[model samples]
Target chain A: MLENIISELEKQFQLEAVDHNSSDLVFLTIDRDHAVMAIDLLKWKFGYKHFVLLTAVDFLEEGKFQLTYILNNPDTKTDIGVRVRIDREDANMVSAHHLWPTVATYQRELKEMFGIDFPGSPRLNDPFILEGWEGTPPYRRDFDTKAFAASFYHQREGRTTNDPATYMKEKLYPNE
Target chain B: MSKKEFFPMDGDRTKYPEIKSDGTADIDLSSHKYIKLWHGPNHPGITGNMAVELTLCGDEVVEGITHVGYLHRGFEKLMERRKYIQNFPLVCRIAVPEPDYNEYNYATCIENLTGIDVPEKGMWLRTLTLEMARLQGFLMWIGGMAGAIGFGTVGQWANYCRDLVLDRFEELTGGRIYHIYILPGGVRNDIPEGFKDRMEKNLREIEGFMKDIRRAFFDNYVFKKRSVGVGYIDPAWVFDYGIVGPNARAAGFKHDIRKNYPYAKYAELDFEITTAKDSDIYTRAFLRFEELLKDIDLIRQILDKMPEKGDHISKVSNMMNLKIPAGETYVRSECTRGEYGYYLVADGSEYPRRVNVRGPSYTHGVALLEKMLVNVNIADVAQLMVSLHTYPPEIER
Candidate 1:
């Protein structure tokens, strides 16, 4: 059933990769430019109408961010995850809010958290979780959370870590 | 079937900031015709710490900007650093009213990524707890829904009824609010002795209270007047906005995750999906009430079908350092409010590469609420919000 979608899609655009995770779920990779068009095809032509989610994963070592758009078909009960890779340094992509209005919210979060830019998405500049966050997008791998916390807050004195086995042996069964 | 033919909405799009082709109205603050009002972060009408900035023209709201992040704990970023097993305790904090959905989805995602087998008894126990969570979640929502419209008596009765279900949870999982019971490979423990009988007793008492609530809340003229046609969720918005659970069900959509994408013991259990065609505040509230009763029957079915004695947990070799392969999968369950999902990405490391917590409220509360709030009377904002059954933590998380 999913093979038909892959074949049909391959005719119009170049297929980067196709993964059949399960009977009802399939993940397909395509170039960033054709990503939105492929998703549009899946929605109108294939009936994958329900917009599940749009999330980005930062691969700092490779200097790339993989954006995954998961769309579900309520009628056929199948899911298609379209994966697109974009450069992390100057991250930008086509806005899909035209397809799903709620995609603007996802795009907003992506813009605020990963420094990704969706030019035409509404409220793309407004903060999602943080109102005026100025530092590097916190979700990026290069952004060290421990360093951020250590620099911003103070550690309380006399706080210590103890291995449960060693601490239990020293306190409960001292002679054992 | 257009609802306009049956019951005309309370008000059509009022004259105010003109709506654009994209279904959004720009709030022009400079105009003296409109006044801005902040509807919470502290108000009881809202489920969690969140506020709506309502742009009002007299008593009608022209535009509502949803403001979240007041309660942002940043669990997603925190999960990126924590080990696989370490995040078990933290996932349940995502949704306070019903936390088991988070635990179940997170655990199931981990199991799927690592290819771990959960015992049958464990699956049954997980189902029992999830249904119990749904029952309690709906009970709490009823309290909020009734209280939103000044029906305080029903709220009190609903809370008391909810305490009965929490008592059952206390006995089974050893905690009232956060059970942390459903683990990755299976469950934390076996069912307690006489737990079924105790739960059955509570279910009967709850059923009795539900009947009383139906009379006091649903049948009342004030509730009907305030909610009957107050907020109508267009059936077309079901797929557009990713609406799920009772919200979509109330819109006459038979799209229940447990039925469409069966998981746990739901495939073995028999139940009907609750649905209605009205798609208004009253219809959604009443649909949820009916679903609350169905949950009681499902609890009974689980108790009857469960095995007598068996393994409830599978042992993982290492507790502290469990490394998962590079894979990504999305696991979801039919939660009380809607379809709660966990999208996990593991990069062959002890720490999860990325974890996206998908709460049904992410759509219903923020974007949909903002859209629905336009042109609605200020007085009905709370009632309309409660009808949507949104939890703010899910949005900010």
Candidate 2:
């Protein structure tokens, strides 16, 4: 079923079948230009109406973040994972909000977290986190977590707090 | 199939409320007819922090506005800062009422990425815990549903039974509500000595409690009248909205991930997938009734098939020493409400690069609630919320 769907998708979009392991499913990495169109076609032509998830990954070393859309077809019992790689220099893609209305909020969330621009999405301005955030997006791979946390958040001022295991050892057996 | 009949909502039509239209829909702010009522932040019927602004025309709701993110603590962003082991306790707060789901899915995602398989005995134990958690969640659902329809006695009875389940959790994990017991590699510990007998005793007590639940809740005429044709959904909407668990099952869809995906020991366990055909409040409520029985049977199966010799958890090095290879994985599980997915991105580090939770409540709260509230009466607001089982924290996360 996945092969059939991939074959059907390949006719329109520039698609490459990728390797993924979990259960019965096939993943394909597609060009960003055809991401929305391909997904719309799949949802319309095929029975893959369920938008399971929409997530983005930051690959700083590779200079790109991969955005994946996992869709499932309950009628056929087949799943398809389609991904689009957006370069860090121009992290933008046409929003799938038109085809799947549910993707609007998710796209806005991805924009806030990864700093990717979804030009067509209506709710991109809504604040999900970091009220009045300035400078860089907090979810980018290049964003240094320790530095950001130290500069922004309030830190403990006393001796370093120990973990659960260390705290148990220290409090329970003081002499030892 | 014929369309399901729903009770006519009682109320007058009013104007739109205070939500500024962001190019989606225009509101006539000049009109003085509409009254805005906020039902959120802290409310008896609502499970978590959520507010629904209803523009009422007398008793009827004209325009319903959903307000989420009151309890949003940025859990996904926080997951990026903590190590694998350090996140166990934090992720439990993602869904406060059903915290095991976050732990189980997070653990399963990491385990899938690291290629660490749990032992047979551990699998059985995890299944046992999952079923117990499902029962606890179902009882809470029943209580909340009953309370929504003014059946206060049902809430008392179901909550009383739920306390017994929480007692078992407190004995096992030292936490009544948020049991961070289901880790990635395996459970926190083996079932304690004579724990099976104790669990059996609790199940027997719950079994007796089910009788009262049927008598006071299901058998009651008032509840049936309130729930029989209320909050009707087209059965086909289950496929479109991707709803799961009892909600979809009640709508006549058999898309149980446990049966289809066969995670943990669910493949080995023999139990019926609870389903119904009415797609109304009563059928949704009845699905829970069938699920309670199935939960008991699955727990018994776990106790019978649990292996004798196997480690409860694998010995791993410190969190700093553990590193996941650079990859991405999405692991989904059948939670009490619906299908919950955890999409994680690992960059060969102790902390995940990205953790996006596809919580089920987000779908129900935003898309389904907005769609379902188009012509519903104001009185059915709490009932709709209860029947849909929307968790605001899960949505906000």
Candidate 3:
């Protein structure tokens, strides 16, 4: 079932890469421009009607943001994750709201959390899950959460916090 | 003269023009009437910590906008920094009412990434716990729905029944609200001695209450009149709005993660998907009631079919030094509300690279609520919101 979906997707678009990570999971990477087209093909041509999830992963060293769109077919119970890589400096992609209107909320969320721009989406720049947030997008790898917490939130004083690895080492090899 | 003299101010307004002249009395007769109203954030009718900004024309809403994030803690970022085992307790906090779905999804995702296979008894135990949690959530939903519609007694009865279920949980898991019982390899512990008998006793007690619940709540004519044809959702909008769970089932769409994409021991269970065609508050309520009954039957089947005794937790490496293989997987579970999925990315490190919770409430609470609120009667706002079963923590997270 998954193979059929993958072959159909590959036949239609020039997929940059396609890999099967595990059973019932298919990963396909395409250029940012073909994201909407690929998703439309998957939704209409293939029977993947459910828009399961949409999220972003920040790769600071690579200087790119990986946008994953997960679609599920109810009949086959298979999930196909469409991957699109956008430039970190100018993180922009076409909106999938035309296909699935609920993507507007997810796009709005990504815009707020990762600074990704979904140009044609409604309320793209609206504040979502963050009010008056004026710093680097919190989910980006470069954003220092510890530093942010120290400056903004109250921290307990006179208490030492150790890294998990350090704590594990001290506890496991106390005699050493 | 006698009636008018008794209450002079109650006469026709235009006949008695002096009443209109008073400073305190003012009436505007306009074709277009627009009043801005804020519906929540702390309102009793609100399901959780979220608000709807509604523009109403007299009694009909013109437009509605959802405002969330009153409970945002950036759980995704927080989980990314915490160790694998450290995240088990925190994931359940994402969905407060039904925490087992979150725990199961997170545990399964990690187990998938780490290549750990749970034993047969462990699978049955997880399924049992999942169904138990679903019943508890349905009980809470019944209470909330009844409360929304001015039936306070039903809420009390439902809460009492739910408390009995929680008592069983407290006995087995040692925690009432947040069990944190599901771990990566399997459940935290096996069921105690005579736990099944106690659970069956509670189930029978709930079964006894079902008849009274039907008589008082479901069979009442006032509830039917108030709920039927109210909060109508067209079947076409189900896909566009990402509706799921009982809401979609009420719309005559047979989309259930348990039946469609069976997880844990659901594949082995014998149960039918319950649905309705009305797509209104009444149908949703009916579907939840029927699903609750189905859950009871499912729990019985799980208990009967489970192995007598086996290892609940499979042997795994030390949790403190556990490192998952570098991979990404989207694991989904049939939560009480809908399809709750977790998109986990592991970079072979002590901490997760990213953990994105795809909460069903995110769509139901914000997008669908905003869309359905348009032109709806103001009286049905709370009914519509609760019928969708929106959990705000999932939305904000």
Candidate 4:
């Protein structure tokens, strides 16, 4: 089933390097323009009806936002993650709302959380899952939550800031 | 059958104007008859920390919009920053009523990414914890549904019965609400001695209450009248909106993750995928009641069949230095609400690159709620919302 999806994606989307390294997960990097088309094919032709999830992973080092659309075929019980990397400067992609209406909410959430834009979706600009008065998209790696919290909310008088990883390293592996 | 024939509207077929191609209804909400009302954030009818904005024409809701984020803690972001082990305790709080599913999903995702194999006893223990969580979640749903419709006594009864399950949980996991038992390698510890007997006794006691539950809630004429046709989800929309668990089963769509994609020793269990034909509030409630019975049986099977003496957790080299190789996986479990999936991306570092939690309520609470609320009576709004079984924290997360 996964091989069939990979070949079909290659044939239709044309000239794409796909990553199938993960078990039970297929990652296809498609052009930002063909994201909706790829998803439509997966839905109508490939029997991937379940739009499981849509999320963005920010790779600050790569200077791109990798938008992943997780689709599931109930018959095969296979999950396919379609990833499209868009320029961080121009973080925009065609919305998958036309293929699945639920994507509107997911896209709206992505827009609010990652500062991504889905121009064609309904309520694309609506405040979704987040209220007004935002500084940066909090989900992005560049947005330091600790600094933001310290500035916006109250903190203990003498409490020192500590990274969770560093704190765990010191507490758990002191001898090492 | 054609769309028009199957979905027969009351208006004249020929003379009735066609719906606009853009899918917008030509209705004016600014008229004097239309009144806007907010149904929650604090409303008892609402399930959790969320609200629905309803545009009502007299008693019928013309349009409804779900408003969330009252409980948004940015769990995904928090998980990304925290070490893998630190996330176990935090994920449980994502879903208040049923925290074990989140814990299970988180652990399973990490295990899948890290290629950590749990022992046989661990798998059985994990399954037991998941089922126990489902029982308590179903009990909470019963209470919420009954309370929503003003059936206070059943709510109290179900909550009391649920406390028995929690007592067992506290005895085993050291916490009643947030067990934090299911870890990445396996469970936190083995079931305490005499735990099986105590759990069986509790299950038998709850089973004894089943008759009264059926009589008071399921068979009550008022409940039947209020819920029979109050929130009917068309079977056609089941897959379109990605409804699962009891809601989809109640709609006659036999899609259970436990049966279809078994995880955590579910393949060894012998149970039927219970379903109902009617996709209404009543059927949804009845389906949950039926599932509670099945869950009791499942717990009994796990307790009886589990290995008597074995290691509950596989030994990890070190907690602080543990780093999963770079990989991505979507691990899901048959949560009480539905298919709760955790999409994990590891970056070969201490912290996860990204963690996206696909809670079932994200679809049920927001998209499906907004779509189903149109033309529904204002009185049945909360009833229908509770029937969908949405937890707002899951949605906001």
Candidate 5:
């Protein structure tokens, strides 16, 4: 059933890579430009109407951010994750709020956390969670959370915490 | 499909703001027609924290902007640096009401990525905890929903019922609120002896309270009058707005994750997806009440079918030693509110490359609340938000 749908999509849109995680879940990695167009086809043409989520992962060494859009077809009980890779240097993608109202929220978070801009998205600059955030987007791979917190937030005296695993190794198995 | 069929919202037309060419409410404060009101950030009538910046003309809300971040803790960011095992207890804190779903999804995602199979008995126990989480979550939601409409006694009764379920959790998982029971491979521990009998007794007591809840809360005229036709969700908005669980079900969509996807022994469990066409506050509340009763039946079914003696958890020698292969997968389950998910990415490393929490509240609490608040009475905002069944911690996560 899924083969037929994928074949049909392959005939229309340019297919980059197709990998199956499970029997029902198929991951389709497409070019950045044609990602939303394929999503439009999946939503309007195929039965993949339910927009599950939109998220990005930083592939730091590769200098690219992989954006994944998971959509669900309720009728067939299947999911297709459309992945698109955009350059990290100039991080921006076409906005998808026209497809789903909730996509705007995801885009807003992406802008605030990952520094990924979604052009034409409403309230793209509004902070979703972090208030008055001015530094590098925290979710980016290069952003050091420990360094940021130590410099930004103050700690009281004698309030130092220790990692239990590391503490156990230091106290019990130090000679190893 | 028009909302007016459900309930014709009444308001003074002259006082109402006009819609601009861009489809936004032309809420000019200089005209002195609308006054801005903040709903919360301080106990906004829900357990979690979030405020709706409402532009009101008289009693009707012209527009509402949902302002959040009071509970933001950067959970996703924290998970990136921590090892896989260190995040076991962390995931449960994402959603306060039903943390089991978070644990289950996080565990299952790692298991899927690592190719770990849970024991049969472990699967059954996970299902039990998930259903139990749903049971207690619904109980607490009943309290909040009833309390929203000035039914304070029912709220007390619902919380009491919720406390009984928490007792069962405390015995089984050693935690009432956050049960880090569902691990990557299996559950934390086996069910204690005589747990079935005790749970049965508790179910009976809860069923008795449920009878009172139905009579005192649902059958009450004031609750119906305040909620019957209010907060109507158009069925068309289900897919477009990413609505799920009871909110989508109440709008005549027979889409439940358990029914559709059938994860974690739910395929064997016998239960019907409760739905209503009304899609308003009262219908959603009543539908959830019915589902709470259904959860009791499911718990009994799980208990009846559970094995007497077997491995409740699989062999994972050390949680800290676990690692995932290079891959990405999304795992979701039917949480109390909707489809709660965890999108995991592993780069063949000890620490997770990225773990994004797809909490149900991320959509329902923010975008859905803002969209639904238009033309609603200031008093009905809490009722509508509660009926959508959103959690602020999940939203912030």
Candidate 6:
């Protein structure tokens, strides 16, 4: 069934069906431009109707990231996985909301958290997180976790003391 | 089937858009409609923090609008901020009623991503816990459905039985509601000294309880009257809406994640996937009951075939700091609620780059419920809602 999908999709969209050892899980690769179209075709032609999830992986050294749309078809009892790679410099993809309405909200969520751009999706302007801020997206690999956590959250204000000195003064040498 | 007649819906279908796009309609908070009804942001008949405004035109409902996003704690997006270990506890909050579903899915994702293999004993333990959770979750669903259908006595009996299962869970995991017990490497502990014997006893007790359920609620005249033909869903739309678990099986879809894609020791268990041919509320409710019985049988199989003495958990070399391989994997499990999946994207860092949770309730609540609500009487709205058994927090998460 997946081979049939791969053959028909090659004519309409640029797709690469990668061979992997992950049995029972079919992973298909598509360009960022045709990701949503491929998703629509898979749903319409095949029985892959359920939108499983949308996630993105960051490759800092390679300077690119991969976004995957996992779908499941209960009728066929099969899983159809579609993936697309976007450059870290210009991370954007066509919004999938036109075909799958639920994907629209998920795309907006990805944009807010990962700083990825989905041009056609509405609600991108809505402040979902980090309202009125000026910085890189918190979800990107380049974003420093320690810096973000220390800056935004509560921590010890401006005092420094050595643990050894405190331990000695409080416990062992009481007279000193 | 005439187009002009438009198949008169039980309520004002025109108020909410036939297609749930961004904004063909908004929640109508005001206006004078004879009987104003608030169907729970906290009241009975509604699950979690959601309410439906029902303006009734005498016993018949004139209009209804749903209000949601009240318990949105943002667990999905927050998962991106924490490491894989920390996210285990966080994901449990997505569905408070059935939390092991999230934990097992999360653990499976990390296991897949890191290429770690759980031991045979660990695998059996995980399977037993999962099936036990399914039986407990089904009992809760039956209770909620019985109460919604006005079978108050049945609800009480089911709740009483479910408490026994909860007691077992608490003793097994050390926590009653959210057992943050399942981890990436393996489970938190081995079966206690006498846990297997205790579980077998509980299963026997539950078997007896299931018999009472058959007599009290399943055979009751009102339950059969209100449930059999009401809230009919086409079996063909199962793929379209992406329904899962007993709901999908009830509609004649033979998709069992455990059988089709065996993750844990489910491959070893000998059990049939419970399904129902009728596509109505009663069939849906009965499918869950049948699944409860099947889960009891599966739990027995796990206890019997499990390795006698072995490590229950895999040792974690480092908990706080460890470099994750830069890769992506979507791991799905047959959770009690439905097909719970975790889409984990690692970036060679301690924390995950993107952690999106694909829960069944999200699709079931929004897309599927909108379709099922069509032609259903507003009086049966809560009953249908309870029968569907959606956890809204999982959706908004």
lDDT (C-alpha) at residue B245 in model 4: 84
Candidate 6, residue A14: Cα displacement in angstroms equals: 3.3
> Which numbered prediction scores highest in TM-score against the true structure?
5
Between candidates 4 and 5, the DockQ winner = 5
The residue-by-residue lDDT of candidate 6 on A114-140, one tens digit each, is 788998686675554345656887667
All candidates' TM-scores? Answer: 0.94, 0.87, 0.90, 0.92, 0.95, 0.80
State how far residue B12 of model 4 sits from its true place (Å): 10
lDDT of each: 0.90, 0.79, 0.86, 0.86, 0.89, 0.75
Top-down TM-score ranking: 5, 1, 4, 3, 2, 6
Give candidate 2 misplaced runs (Cα > 4 Å).
A60-63, A88-90, A122-176, B1-6, B10-26, B317-320
User: Which digits, one per residue and each the tens of the lDDT, describe model 1 over residues A34-140?
Assistant: 99999999999999999999999988889999999999988888888899999998899999998998999999999998999999899999978888898898888
| Residue lDDT tens for model 5, B1-397 | 5545548664344545776688777778988878988888886385578888889988888889988889888888889889998998788888888999989998999999988889999999999999999999999999998888788999999999999999999999999999899987889899999999999999999999999999998999988888988988999999888999899999999989998899999999888888899898988999999999999999999999998888987787666867788988889999888799999999998999989888778889888889898889888888999999888888778
Order the candidates by DockQ, highest first: 5, 1, 3, 4, 2, 6
Give the Cα-based TM-score of candidate 2 against the true structure: 0.87
**Residue B75 of candidate 2: its Cα lDDT?**
84
Candidate 4, residue A132: the lDDT equals 85
| Superposition error at B44 for model 1 (Å) | 1.5
Q: Write the per-residue lDDT of candidate 4 for residues B1-397, one digit (tens) a residue.
A: 5544332221242322223678754445555667789998899999888999888767777778899989988898988878999998789889998899989988888888788889999999999989999998898889999999998998998998899999999998999999889887899988899999999899988998878989998999999977876677888887678787898999898889999988999999999999998788899999999999999999999999999999999988887667999878788888878899888888899999999989999999988999888767789888999999999888878
lDDT of 3 by residue, B126-237 (tens): 9999999999999999999999989999999999999999998999799999999998888988988898899999999999888899999999999987787777788998
Report the C-alpha lDDT of model 4 over A64-152, residue by residue, as the tens digit: 99888899888988878888889988899887787777889988888989999988899888786877847788888999888898998
Query: What stretches of model 6 exceed 4 Å from their correct place?
Result: A1-12, A15-21, A26-29, A44-47, A55-67, A73-78, A85-176, B1-38, B53-66
- Interface C-alpha root-mean-square deviation of candidate 2: 2.6
Clashing pairs in model 3, backbone N/Cα/C closer than 3 A: none
lDDT of 2 at B198: 89
DockQ for all candidate structures vs. native = 0.59, 0.33, 0.54, 0.48, 0.62, 0.23
Of the pair 2 and 6, which is ahead by lDDT? 2
**Which candidate, 4 or 6, has the higher DockQ?**
4
Off by over 4 Å in 4: A21-23, A154-176, B1-22, B25-30
